[model samples]
Target: MSSDKPQNASESELPQAVPVRRRRWAPSLVWLIPVVAAVIGGWLAVHAVLSRGPTITISFQNAEGIEAGKTRIKYKDVEIGEVTSVKLSPNRQSILATAQLSKEAADYLAEDSRFWVVRPRISGGGVTGIGTMLSGAYIGMDVGKSAARKSEFTGLETPPIINADLPGHTFFLRADNLGSLNTGSPVYFRRVPVGQVVGYELDAKGGFVRVSVFISAPYDRFVTSNSRFWHASGVDVSLSADGLNVSTQSLAAIALGGIAFETPLADNAGIPLSDRNFILHDAREKALQNPDREMQPFRLRFHQSLRGLSVGAPVDFRGITIGEVTAIGVEYMPERKDFDMTVDIRTYPSRLDTLSRGSRISGKLSPQQLIGNGMRAQLRSGNLLTGQLYVALDFFRDAPPAKLIVRKGMPELPTIPGDLEELQRVLQRIVKKLDAIPFDNIGQQANDSLKSLQQTLDSVKALSDGLNKETVPQASKTLEQLQQTLEATRQTMKADSPLQQDVRSAAQEVKETARSFRALADYLDRHPEALVRGKEAQP
Candidate 1:
């Protein structure tokens, strides 16, 4: 009976079981696990893109329009990469453009590819990229794959070469209107583009312009030592008559101008060129290196007319420019006591070097050409209105062989004749002579002669009246005296008579006085300085 009661209690206990409920572990944790995993995976994907290629940081002096991710770089007009980030360098001297290059750009990236900001610039050489000057463009590159210089991708402050590279070349030149010569200006050879401008810097300290020119690789060897470069962009000098001009040919070209370089054909071995870089030139040294050298700078003192020419004028040799004007001033002549201006000339050194100056040289001559072999000096007109003069050179055979003459300060240059100066001097001398005539003395002499004639007529009429009328005693006496006087006057006409000789001598004195007076006046006019010690005044 006790066993049965225990079994029923056990069954009743089972009926007192528990209700079904959620455990302590959350069911939301299943969805939360997946959420955390997704966040981590998204972060990993971004990291992969960031680390896709080699990191390159390009530093520039300025970063006006550049922005990370916004700036893109193109290779052969194909978009290759975008900037990843922008940060100031340690010293704050430059802006570092960190870029994340794509696979293609990264593959072709060589040691020589260049990077530079596309910013507008203005210079004395020229103005450039004026159309899009307000909104700058993306960075540009000249991608090159080469064995040389291809170690790593390090962004350069200088721009890369856009055109082909030149092998062996060197050109010396000046940049006047170079404002347009930016990182993208095109370089032309015989009007055909073979190179491009890479970079530029203002060389204020050097007194010259610094320009980086890159010739395409194949043509690189063609550029030789006998070359010259000059800015071809627009330039305004405020000329007296010529108006404003504009030169726009390329995006990289200066808005005002571009550069023109020449490589003269020569068999001689020329200078070798490494990679392209900015060239700083000294104008004086370059002039000395030119092939056609000139005579050393010499001054020619000119007292006579040089064709009425003057300063800033061209000095020509066979119609080619050879020299320029330096100065012109007058100096006193001790003998003539007059002033004469001497013209100074500055000839090109190259032209001077070739001249056998002062050496006993001989050559053929022609009267018509007035030029033969020896050096001849002449005048050139620079500014017609200003009457500026410059010295010019010519060759004459028959003309006196010019001898190099050295003076105390600066040697004078050779000079030529001028029709204008000759005419002017002749007119001036004539005027001086005319001004010296003695009109006052001549007038007094004429008045005296007319009075004497009048008196003689009056005396003759009185004598006639006395003869026609009955003679009064006083009249008779006057007539007798008159007759005696007339007889005496007639006798005085003889060279020997005492009274006649006196009158004759007085007339001679008058003639001599007129001549002496004229001579004195002429002497005073020609030599006015002598007037200070002239003869004593006549009473």
Candidate 2:
């Protein structure tokens, strides 16, 4: 009983001693974790919102030169934006490239801004953008000048040949054919490059091809209203009377072709205008030959064969080109009752101008007036080797009287005889002279002379035979007889003959008599006058 009481009292005393300081409800450290997390998350959200940039969607025919994460958009070769994603549009006909542009570049996006894939290209001008090969292709952007901003853009299929700010003038050139000239073909002035062909399009009327070209400053001032443009493609080899003429620009033009222009020496005095239309000629000669003038139509009747002549054959005046043949047709004239050729020719009055050129010709200088002044047309040989013919006009002061007639509103000019007709007339005269020759009588006389010559030859042959046979033998016998007579005479004169001995004795006697006569003369000389009796007495 004492132990139980002590245990109970001990329990009560211990519990009372703690005084049980009432446990107050307080917050735990676990609640602080959520609050700290909220503060950090709020700061991160604000930072992300502040750093975000404008998003732009670019449409392209195909997704080329673009990477979702790695591809960068460059302006002036500086990175200003990055491609974020590439997706197809709702129509699925094109690729939509969404890009994130830097805040500064956002203002640069405009309607006029151009974006194109920069790739390696080989053009008439030569290889360009070749760096794209090693670095891989990339998108090139040309910043627009417009103040208006736009986030979306459509990409270009090809890079522009001329930059809008290239500091030059853009002009149009119309041609019937594109030739070998392509974009980037050089535009040359006197073979020095000054510009390039940018682009081309077909006319809506299908009449011609229109090409766009750019001419840089300083050189642009050289192009005038009368400046002529022509295709300068490859080496122009012309075999002419002057000799073989070989002309070439750069080696690039030899392969890819090019365009060249020059202000004609005749038309260089005109003022130049900006952005004008110029005709594209097929060749340099064609461009040089072209005259800016009003064309007057005329007709010529050719009685001779129209060989070595074409529609575009030149019409010349004193070796100077004045027009060209436009058409050639053969029609029978019921009155003439023969096939007559109707040749249509267009004459340019500008060719006659020494200074200013006028289009409209007055009635005072009409075709009828010119024909009345002895102006005649004739065909002449242009090239001897080629046998090419061209129409020639000159004042034929000796030409017979003729008149100009109008038919179908076109002036019909009188044509004098061409060289071929003159040649034919000469041949006809020769034939007539040949016909007048007495060929049959000459043949008969020639036969008679041949017969007489044969008879004379036969007589000579008989004489030769008589000389060789009978005459030769008789002459030989006579010569032998004469030899015999000489031998007889020689024998008579021999040393052993009596006749020779008698002649020797007579010669000795004469010699002795001469000795005696000489001795007598010597004695007479000594005795003074021995011729008297004195010489005998002395003897």
- Which candidate has the top score in lDDT? 2
- Top model number, TM-score: 2
- Candidate 2 clashes: the total is 0
lDDT tens per residue, model 2, 337-380: 99987789988876676333554344338777788889999988
Q: Estimate each model's TM-score.
A: 0.44, 0.64
Lowest lDDT 10-residue stretch of candidate 1: 360-369
lDDT string, candidate 1, 360-460, tens digits: 22232222233224566766555679776555576645556455556767654444455466677899999999889898998899999999999999999
lDDT at 286, model 1? 39
lDDT of 1 at 417: 56
